[model samples]
Target: MSERKKSLITTINNQRKYSQVAKAAVLSSAMLARKNSSSRGAPGSAAPFGARESIAAISDMLSTQHKKPVRSSYVESDRVEWALKIACTISMITVCLHTPRTIELFPPLTYIILAADFISVSVFMLDSVLRIHYEGIFRCDSSYLSNRWSQFSVFISIIHLLSFLLHCYQLIGKLHFSEISLILLFSDKFFPFLHLNYRVWYGVIRSIRPFIIIRLIPLIVKFKLPKNRIEQLLKRSSQQVKNVTLFFVFFMTLYAIFGIQLFGRMDYHCVQPKTDPNNVTIMDLAIPDTMCAPEGIGGYECPNPMVCMQLNLNAKGEGFYGMFNDFGASVFTVYLAASEEGWVYVLYDCMDSLPSYLAFLYFCTLIFFLAWLVKNVFIAVITETFAEIRVQFSEMWQKKEVTLDEGFRKKLEKTDDGWRLIRLDGEVEAEGPKQKLQWVSSL
Candidate 1:
């Protein structure tokens, strides 16, 4: 009887254990079902289990992820950023030295420049490829090529790449990459013409390369110089610079039109060849045969001091008005004149037939109004903006301090209303009473 009672107790214990396991399984299954239902309703949980991405998606991923492989580890690093800046500095210097004028001055410098260019181009090309990968090739709305600045950078990089290749071509001569004997033999004949074309392209590219200085300017401005006073000044005066630039454009356009009217129909002439025995060879004269006076004694020769003549009122070719037909040329010429660079030559060329007083008036107007008055205006505006910016920065710093004290974190958020600064705390609602209050008080 004692053994049978002990066995019954063991069986009861076993049954209780089994009941507990069954309860656990039921509870777990119920919980899983609830989780699955919730997940199905949740946003961004619609993807089917183990579904493969489409070929287009995979292609895009491959294209966009080329840089992603190293981006986090290298690209955003401060060390890399500084390295890039150094590379840009190198590039800028290389570009300056490689200019046709500079190269002409120092021909042997091309080899050194070519070496430097290789370094610069390699850096820029790698960077450009990575940037394009990051921005995505086919993203029309937000692609690498979409932003004007990005486009400028990529374009500059490509042109520089071509320039580098051209340099390599010149250095390598008729050396063939492939083992085709026909190409190798005939390359001697074909390469010179090809190189000549390349030189023309190289010149054009080099001329445009200076515009890369625009890209370099911003980088230079942002550089952390020892004093940082210049940076502070530039940051403070940014708004003023923008405003003044706009006004200057408008002013320049107006003056350019005025300049076109004054010097539109104009030309320069040479001594009447037939009349002057010193010029026995009529063919030798630069002036057209029609422009020279007859061989008679009383023939009207060009003026002694100057040989320039006024073109017919409706005349074209090389005159200010003829050039003005293109808007870009007109603006460039006017601004070029304003810079006083070949302004004297242009002044002499334009004013040969016009009154001397007109020259005085034109120079005075440009020097006094554009140079002095306009310059002072910009200076004043920049000074005002600088003061305002200083105050603005001070206020911003104070606000940041206050937020830190209040245990609040501010973040930039892009909403329907556009980018907005908002506190992370529950105290500030996204676009409700708290935001409205903050905006009103800040104003």
Candidate 2:
């Protein structure tokens, strides 16, 4: 062959070798990445495949070898599982609908509710057991028992067991069993003086059945968009949320302390004087416009000492109901005022009781800080965090798309050898073999 032709062939051969080497390198890197990913059994590190896992693997192999393949037609379908879940949900809803009054008034409904409870509890127990067996034994997950779902399952089982016993007690009560026999069977007749009313205990257990609705959380979390967004929001904004909460609590406590100091002992209320025809004075006839403190305090005396009764300042005149009875009560009252719900009444009471009108300033300042400023700040923080998270997700998605596009372009470039060959033919036609030969020789 001519020197020019040989030089051209050598140049093409060199290019082909370079392409093969680059492809090999890429393949090798990909394989290495896959190996590394597969080797990593846990976060941040590789886990050793232990002897127990080896034994379990061997047992699984032996079991599968002996096990007969089941027909797909006979297999339990997802629809069946979902049906059971729906039924369980309905049963739980029925249980929630049953109140003590309903059970008492409608005697026959009690048995129906009991039956529903039994079905729901049984389904939950079965599901929990299957989950535990699958996660702990079949999957051989050591941390399965420590999982929140597993813990919740265990809790549900315990409560259901107690509820089942209560059901039995309730049934026995319906059977008209003697109280003495019941006390002996349950309490071992230890406290004969203590009244053992199984009915009341049964009612308490029934009340707790409403909490079974929490089981639906797993189903609710199946909604990917909302659930994932909520999870991301919480995870990314946890520190910000904590900071806001701390600030809110600190300010609330400060306002509550101020409230306690200002209105702690201000229990004065307007009381109407007695109007008797026989011994009626002008003061007695006058409307009770003056405020009087609770009895035993040396405060303003009313016109009718015999008949002036202390009026109830607020509904439910207990410590908790009082606006500023104690530190805890003051805190709750401050929360109410900050929420701006029925706080005008409290403000009026405070204004009426206190001699000065500075109470308005205190409340206005509290409302401005907590209700207006702090509330808006909290909303803005959450909104900003959500926006940031959304932007980050969008950027990641764009990067992924760009990477995919680059990979696709590289694939097209690799596959279009015919086009390259055609271009090379054109180049040979445009510049004769002698010129190509000289170029190759120079290279």
Highest lDDT: give the candidate number: 2
| Candidate 2, 124-185: lDDT as tens digits | 67766665655563354444466666687567666866776677666775554787456545
Could you give me the TM-score of model 1 versus the true structure? 0.47
Model 2 misplaced stretches (Cα beyond 4 Å): 1-80, 137-143, 178-196, 199-211, 220-235, 272-319, 384-443
Q: Which 10 residues in a row give candidate 1 its minimum summed lDDT?
A: 49-58
Clashing pairs in 2: none
lDDT of 2 at 247: 88
Query: Candidate 2: minimum summed lDDT over ten consecutive residues — where?
Result: 418-427
lDDT of each: 0.58, 0.60
What is residue 418's positional error in candidate 2, in angstroms? 27
TM-score of each: 0.47, 0.60
- lDDT value, residue 363 of candidate 1: 61
